[model samples]
Target: MRIAFVSFETVYHRDTETSQRFRTVCELFAARGHDVNCYCAGFWAGEESAFERNGVTYHAVSSGTEARSSFLLRLPFVLATASPDVIHASAQPSSQVLAASWGSTLARAPLVLEWYGDDGVSDTRWSRLATGRPGRIVTPSELVGTWVREIGADGDIVDTVPNPIDCERIHRVEPGEAVDVIYARRLDEGANLESLLLGLAELRGRDWSAKVVGDGPERETYERLARDLRIEDRVTFVGDLDLEERIAAYRGAHVFAQTADHCVFPTEMLWALAAGCVGIVEYHANSSAHELVEGWDRGFRTTSEDELAEAILAAGDLEHREYDEAFAEYDRSAVADRYLELYRTLQEAQGLL
Candidate 1:
């Protein structure tokens, strides 16, 4: 099948989780012997038009200093020219989805909108796409599926598929003497880093250290909070790591901690668990991460600061268990197979299969 994957930004940028996830899906599709073409904005390398990377074709829709949003105007032409069997686009930059809608109509290809949580579903374009000009809407989780339905998406076409991870890329590694705790997330608004820091501070009497990974606008504030808690000596702020380093950090840690108010799908926690790190999520109302870890015996959902501190203290003595078998449902291959199945289903619906 000839597949055209659309996004607002180039996957090479790899700046957002959407880019990384979309790249993984594209590569998997290519590996599975499907012809994959990606249409994205040309924000990098000035005026380049088309190129191939990692076995997938990338078509940049813009060249000049025009804002990335301008890609919407050019997307129809790119989609028409590509004439793919299916136009697989993400529901972001809502304008991209809007353009894909227009282009899919012109090209007479089925539009498969992959909705990664509720990022921009409230927008008018998304609402229009959800209710009008029928297409397949793929959601990553039940939480997101429910959200899409609530926002007027066609219930018949909304499909749920979990986010995929490269399980082979994750493995356990022995940690040093100290009980290593890992917290990785963009340090920005709504990060809720203070709760994690305070919880760690409560465990000062225990033999534990932490590595705070990721960089953002709120890094300095978090660093200052760590100092204020007086646990700065034991916590090291190792901002922003590559994929390999992130997996290594997860594997090398005794426990992986997250205290977020909400999450669409907690990929980092899933990765950390797959890497043999004990998981602990501070329960917050409507938090999606809590759904993944609540029932897993090796993980816990703490509702209060005291509970979070207690869980961290108990993690030191909990026997480490192999998580590969438990995490097989989220394996990259499994997710790719599901996506392929969905694509075939869409094709069959259109009498192409």
Candidate 2:
């Protein structure tokens, strides 16, 4: 299948969880013998406006200003070039959605918008518009699947697809000694790292060191708080680890705890699990995260500092999951095959129409 990936400013702007997931998914398809092309904006991996990434072509159209980076003006040009069988984009309603709709209209290709995280509480303003029109809606969890239906999207068109993890790579690091606890996230950007540091301080010398990975705006404040908590000596702020090292950390770490409030999908938790950290997250526990984890083993909820500390210790004390109880269908290759089924279904639907 010929696929055109409608990317956002993210393709070239920064390497974020969302952008990286999109890249990984597209690359998965590309690597599996599908013809894939990525369309981005301004400076895409040293390619002019267009370049190929691992056999998948990536194009960056000029989005006028660097700030907003809306590619509304470049839609037609991108459509004319690739003329894909399907245009799958990430995120909710954005210029990418509009472009995908327009490009599909012009080329008669199906447009599949892969909605991973909820934009705010509900779908964004643009999402309503996109759903009101015709397009295939893909969600990462069954929770979002219901929401899409509630919004009057075609029930048959809505598909549930989980984010694929690099299981082989993450699990390659042999599990050895298990560290007590780990909290992985950029310390800044309202990532809720301060609370984690304070929580760690509350449990210092309990034979656990917090692996404070990732650097951010809150580094100084977090470090200072660690000192204030009188747990500075015990904590190891190892900064960010490369992909391999991160997988190793996950393999060796016991508990993975972070506070993302109530975000729909926390990618870090997925990574932590791939690395074999029993997950404890402090989400609102009312949204999709709670729903995704419903009935799933290896995950628990912690809503307060005391609860977080207790949960961390509990996870730490628990024995590592035996092979059977440990593995879920959410692994990398498993997820890729699921998405492939979705792609084939959407392509066939477009072909019939």
Candidate 3:
């Protein structure tokens, strides 16, 4: 399949979760032997219009990321030139989707929009029009898909394809020294670690230790909260660990608590679940974390600090596991297959298959 990825700003222009996800998908498609080309503002240090890396080709729509209007003006022509089988695009700067739609029409290709919903969406006329332009829309979770539909996209075109994880790595990495509980996510205001800390404080009498696995602006605030709760010694602030280290922590811990106030998809929670940790997700109106464990036996959902503490206690009754096969559906290969399936389906609908 010849896949064209349209993004005005690439990961090189600005390293963001959305940009990174776009790049990851392009690379995955390329690795799977699909001809993948990305159209974005040039990130390489040269006047080159095109650059090749990791079996994927990147075509510069503009010299750099500063000129958004210029990128939009030139994007359609550049994308049409590729004559791709399918056009996959990021949903930020929503107007880009509008331009890509023109390009898809010119190229006679189907357009699939990827909306992570991590980046804030501006409610403008352009955005509304862009929402309805894509033949298909993909989101990390149904929570974001609902928002996409509410913003004017047809629900029939919106699909919930989760963020992929390297489950094989989780299985290969040996567990580190066992801990009682674990919390992983950037310590930002949205971290909502206080809920987990307060819950742990309630169980001070229990001989258990926790490991906080990320660092961010709110690190000191959370550390101070732990100290104030008198659970500082029991809760170790380990900062951010690389993939393997984090997986080891998840495997070593008995419970993984997710309390983030905002999350398009609970990625770390999914990792912990795959690593065999009992998943405990706090119900936040904005977070889609609870969707992962709605009916799972090894998962628990809670609404308050008291309930969080109770879930942790209940998790102790389950036998320790090093891996869970249920989450294999979210593996990188599995998720990539989902994208491929969508692409082929769209191609078939368009008589390209």
Best by TM-score: 3
* Steric clash count of candidate 1: 0
* TM-score, predicted candidate 2 vs. hidden true structure: 0.82
Q: Which window of ten consecutive residues has the lowest lDDT sum in model 2? A: 319-328
Per-prediction TM-score to the true structure, in the order listed = 0.85, 0.82, 0.98
Reference-based TM-score, model 1:
0.85
Q: Write the per-residue lDDT of candidate 1 for residues 1-353, one digit (tens) a residue.
A: 89999987755664666666677778888987889998876645645687787888887776632566578788888799888898998777666777898898888888888777535346465566544454788877667777778777778888878778777766533332334688888888868888889898888787778988899999999999999999999999989988777887777787888887767778888888887778999876545787677668778788777888898888878765434468877888898888878877777887876
Tens-place lDDT per residue, model 3, 102-202, is 99999999999999888655567887898888889999998898888887889999999998898878878999989989999988989999999999999
Winner of 1 and 2 under TM-score: 1
lDDT of 2 by residue, 1-353 (tens): 78887766454466655676677788888888989887766554453666676887876666433633456666756776677777787653365677667777887777777766544425557666666554677776666677767665678777777677666666466653456677777776567776667677668767676677788788888888888889888667888878677767777777777675545566667777756677777766434555444565777776778787777777766676412224457776677788767767766766743
Total clashing residue pairs per candidate?
Answer: 0, 1, 0
Q: Which residue pairs does candidate 1 place in steric collision? A: none
Q: TM-score ranking from best to worst?
A: 3, 1, 2
Show model 3 residue runs off by greater than 4 Å: none
